[model samples]
Target: MGVDNYKLAMWTFLGSECFFFGSLIGTYMSYRGKSLTGPYPLDVFDPAVTSISTFDLLASSLFMVLAVHYAKAGEINKMLGWVAATMVGGLIFLGFQYYEFSHFVHEGLTLKSNLFGATFYVLTGFHGTHVAVGVLLLGSLAWSAKRGHLANIGETTEVIGLYWHFVDVVWIVIFTLVYLLEYT
Candidate 1:
């Protein structure tokens, strides 16, 4: 009966993320190139920073897998360490997002500017929100482990890992379509 509810939860959340990110992408697509300003994607996007953040999020997924593996091995401390590392990676990505958004706003990409601004910000902003939520979930799990509240470490990590992987998958789409696909 070791079905791992933790992992199960992650799958369920990822299913929802599909629709969530899907809408974001759709909105962005519908509004692209409709900007009435000079601060368009090519004009304002710092692809290099975004590319690095994308890679960091991907790395966090790897660390999350390692954490789950350690959890299954009953290495509680190692599991927690990996979870902490994942959180740090997520934070770094968020920091990058904050900087990117701030830079865009400075360059006149406000949601009120035009359709392009509205869709672009909403889509990316929602993704950022998801990342923030994932960070919270990971942080809570880490805290639970530290406080000895987790009954089945493996199960918990499995669930958290599922969510973590889903987050990474979303970013993959975002980077490919939103960031890199700008030239397309």
Candidate 2:
């Protein structure tokens, strides 16, 4: 058969997401050093913590790959296990983000604090929202699989895997530019 409609739609959606995140990253970069206040990126950012969170997100991509592989092989149990693992990884990353945001606020970095605060929170918060959405999608997939409602597990899992990998790639860019580049 030709390309699936759902997969095509997902690719289109991801293309738009790329532009969306590009604009966000551009805005953040434009205002990177223009903050006229305390708690700048260097002052509040802890690379160590963010590094661990990045690792978690990256690991989730591997889980997503395994999930797709198992789904395609008609191994429902293994696919479900990998899906759950991916969701856990996403959740753990979110937990890290929550803690990091809390620490930033406690350190006086609010959205209204300065240019750095506004751009930083907006970009990273949107990313966290995307991660949460991915987790929910995986969760629904798991529920459907468990209930024997997902008829096309391989195709569905592959589509979701594409989204997950896109999310992970975006994080790599963010981690490099927003986090790692600060020190260089």
Instruction: Highest TM-score: give the candidate number.
Output: 2
Residues 39-73, model 2: lDDT tens digits = 88899999889989999999999999999999999
Report RMSD (Å) for each prediction in the order shown. 1.7, 0.9
| lDDT, each prediction | 0.85, 0.94
Q: Let me know the TM-score candidate 1 reaches against the reference structure.
A: 0.92
Candidate 1 lDDT, 53-122, residue by residue in tens: 9889989999999999999899999999999999999899999999999999999888888877788888
| Model 2 misplaced stretches (Cα beyond 4 Å) | none
Looking at candidate 2, the ten consecutive residues that score lowest on lDDT are: 32-41
Query: Judged by lDDT, which candidate is best?
Result: 2
- Model 2 pairs whose backbones collide: none
Model 2: per-residue Cα lDDT at residue 92? 97
RMSD of 1: 1.7
Alpha carbon RMSD to native, model 2? 0.9
